[model samples]
Target chain A: MRYERPTTLKAAAQMLAKEKGQAFILAGGTDLLVRLRTGFIEPDLIVDIKSINGSKTIQKTATGFKIGSAVSGAELGEHAALKKAWPGVVEAANLIGSKQVQGRCTMTGNLCNASPAADSVPALVAAAAKVVIVGPKGKRTVAAEEIPVGPGKTSLKKGEIIESIVLPKRPPKSGDAYLRFIPRTEMDIAVVGVGVSLTLDGKGVVTKARVALGAVAPTVRLVPAAAKALIGTKMDKAALDALAAACSAACSPIDDKRGTRDFRIKVAGVLARRAAVIARKRAGGK
Target chain B: MSGITVNAKINGDPVEFICEADETLLDVLRNRLGLTGAKEGCSTGDCGACSVTVDGRLTCSCLVLGAEIEGHNIGTIEGMAHGEELHPLQKKFIEHAALQCGVCTPGFLIAAKSLLDKNPDPTETEIRFGLAGNLCRCTGYDKIVRAVQDTAKEMRKTNSRKGA
Candidate 1:
């Protein structure tokens, strides 16, 4: 195996394009290294992108923030301004693994790893983040929800890499939260994960909302109907019930050893409702 | 696929070595260099038994490629002590009987040190969460937490005296 560290993004892109599909882009290496040790993958080329310019920075835009694809979870947690703006996103990225793992893992890796149960995916989807993809063709942006097509699969074509994820500006009275049900306290994949981002009006009614669920579908499911249930409402029991029903209605979880199909479906609604409540509270709701 | 040369400072010593692309930092440090304080608990990042500080950042060495640690500073369990005196956390661990099996002790010490660097004084809950990555099955974490707390108090006293 050859390890290539390219200092420039153009050189990195050129190297990846040259290797065709046999090269794996090494981000934080929390996931890629394990696969290498276990012989799960045998790529001839390893393109290390940390040396690339601006690959590990958190740049603030006028609207919101652009987080580098190689930024570690610990780095994200230490950013006071970024944390204050996107606590749910930071907490979800922090939930990927243990403290040491957090020091080396990236949310981009979590998303690109393409695990249906990734803790950060649902949060990114709920936040309406856009991934900036760099390829041999050029640069283009896509919704985070559209990146993961299936389990262990991504829509990124050959020689394409995610440069950063752009989180749009949050309006006033906005808050977001992510919660997941895991059998163990730590070091466990999510049985069901839910993310809720909402904005409220002066009357404390939810003006806009986005609900996303994980581990209950092939890809992270964005439930528009669930969000629709909360709009213009004060998130009372009736509206929360509609939200839960919408979440349950959208689930298609497989019966895995960690959780059964029926159990995951039920927990999806419960988690979604609970997450919506937390998000509402954060958004200064009644 | 040839071996790549790595240049880094391990425990204040500038060291250079060649490692394979598939080689992990923990493996290189233990197998090649014969510094075996960081144990490979699971070979994956799940277990913090292989925790080390690369460039002052707490990380699992197993998750880092050996060649990728170029031009960085590494702190390991072996470098925790100076001369004949043990680090405060190291002494406190022994005094408090923090380890029963000793397999996870190095990792816990390294992790606690990492936490103290960030938070000079951590609450019990903070300590628990900070060291959540490093697991110890023997003492049930009571003694380990106490040891870290005691070390923190002692270190704070030393700092205050220096100020005075």
Candidate 2:
């Protein structure tokens, strides 16, 4: 396979525009190389983005944090500001694969891969993250929830590559948590992943909430009904149960080698409830 | 395929090598430099048998391209020893009998080196988490943990002596 390591974003975009669909963007290459060797992808050219000088930065901006698409999971987990503002994002990044995999896996790559089992997607979606894409058409941003169209499919057009991920400023008295259920802890795909973010009023009632699920559908799903169930509620056991039920109802899982549809649906509810409890605690709820 | 020249410090030695565009860091370490310490058990990065320290970060060499290490410093198991004596972790691994088949020993040694470099005194649980990437199917990990703990003590003793 041919490889091109562009040192600048413009050069990389220009190369992608020139090669079009024949070139694949390489960041980390933890997932891409595996797919390539396994015959899952046969791109004629690989555009290496590691050489791009500015693609590995994590900076705090007016809009919160701009995480470069090429930032490794280890870097994300170790980022001081990221850990303080969005601890769930750090937790989710840390849960991907293993230490070796985390050393090379990128958050943008995880989202671009569009795997239902990707650990980072639920957290990003729950955080209402936005993705910056650069191509021959210039730069555009899209909501994280709208980025993936289906399993292993994205809305990104040809020649476009994810530039960075933009997270909104962390709201006061709000916290997020991401939890995934896998048969074995490390190096296994998620059976059911849940991410929940809740903002609480002084009265301990949830003012706003967001819930996202992964590995239980064709793509990571945002459960609006589940979020609505928690809004204005005091996050009691009954309310949490209702939210979990809503999350389970929202999931449309298929029976696969990893788990049965029934098991996934059941665990989706369990994980959703667990994540909500953690988020509630983080939000300083009683 | 394009040809790339990678210039980096490998095991405290400055080296330059020409690598194929598709070549991974693991390939260069093993095939070109003959540093076979980083074994390729699973090129997919799951096995962690090809773990190495790249610029003070523990990473799977198989997942990184050779060209990606332009000016980075890398440490393999070969770097864990001094002139006439082995590193504390290496000596402790032998004293603690942390290996059976020895296939996973190199990866374990490198991983232990990384963990100790980052945190000189890691708890058993921390050691387990730090070495979670490296898999050892032979030894049940009890001996490995013991080896690391014992090496930490040895290192502390050596440091204290130097301080004295």
Candidate 3:
């Protein structure tokens, strides 16, 4: 295997373009190294992005926060501004692996890995996050939902690498929550993951809602039907039940070692309902 | 394969080594520098036997490459003691009988050191969460937790005495 550490974005893009899909970008190596050791990925070249300047920063912009692709999960969890603006996103990023794994796992690696079980994907989808992609030609931004095409697949063309993730500024009285069902408490893959975000008007009614589910489909799924259940309601028990049912109906899970299909589907509904309730409480709902 | 030179401060010493492309931090630490305190139980991140402090963060040495350690500071279990005197946590572990088979002792020690460094007064739950990554099959963890609590008391006493 060949290793290249480029210090600049342009140099990294040139290297990526030259190697095309044969090159894999190494962020924290929490996932990539394990995959490489297990022969899951056989990239001819490895591009180390840690040396790339300005790729490990998290900054606030006029619109929202810009999370650099190489920002570690631990860093995301500890950022005070991110915790206040998008707590669910921080929670999802924190759930990626154990403390050791979080120390090295990057949000970009989690997203680009494109696993349906990736913890951060559902939260990013719920937050309406945008992915910034850079390549030899130039840079472009795409919706998080549009980035992943299937399991372990992405719409990124050859030589394209994710640069950052952008989350829009959250309005007041808006909150988000993410929860996942795993066999063990920590250091286990998600059987099902749910992210819920709601915006409440002054009268304590949900005006806007976003619900996303993970590990229940080919990719992280945004259930519009579930969100619709809370669009004009007060997030009452009946509304939460309706949203739960919609989320369960929208999922297409498969039986695997982590959990059975029936169990995953059931837990998906439960997590979605719980997340919605927590998010509602966060949004100042009674 | 191009030879990459990794320069870092390891255990309070400036260390430099030439490593191969696929060489992990564990490999460089064990084979090149002969710092065998960090054990390799499961090469994967599941087993925290290879835990090390990289720039004040607990990380699995097996998951990191040697080239990633440029300009970083690493602290292995070897850095815990000062000359012939053992660190307080190490002394407390012995007093509280925190080990039996001793295979997982180094990893546990490093992990416990990390916890105490971060939160000097960690509760039992906090300690459990802090050391959750490191696994110990022997002693059932009751004694280990007691040892950490005892170590915290001892450290606090030492600090108060110095202040006085």
| TM-score, chain B, each candidate | 0.98, 0.95, 0.95
Residue A77 lDDT in model 2?
84
Residue lDDT tens for model 2, A88-186? 878998899877777778999999899998999999999999999888888998999888889888999877888899999977899999999988757
In order of listing, the candidates' clash counts read 0, 0, 0
Candidate 3 lDDT tens digits, B11-33: 87999999987888998999999
> Please, what are the lDDT tens digits per residue for candidate 2 over residues B19-114?
987788999999999999889998888778888888878888988878778899998888878978888888888999999888788888888887
Task: Point out the higher-scoring one by TM-score: 1 or 3.
Answer: 1
**Stronger candidate by DockQ (1 vs 2):** 1
Write the residue-wise lDDT of candidate 1 on B1-164 in tens digits. 57789899999898999999889999999988888999999988887999999988899999999999999889999899998999999999999999999999988988999999899899999998888888787889999999999999999999999999
Measured by TM-score, the strongest candidate is 1
DockQ, candidate 2, vs. native dimer: 0.71
Chain A fold similarity by TM-score, each prediction: 0.98, 0.97, 0.98
How well does candidate 2 score on lDDT at residue A125? 96
Which 10-residue span in candidate 3 chain A carries the lowest summed lDDT? Answer: A13-22
User: In model 1, which regions exceed 4 Å deviation?
Assistant: none
lDDT of 3 at B101: 83
Per residue, candidate 3 scores C-alpha lDDT tens digits across A209-249 of: 99999999989999999999989998888998999899999
How high is the DockQ of candidate 1? 0.84
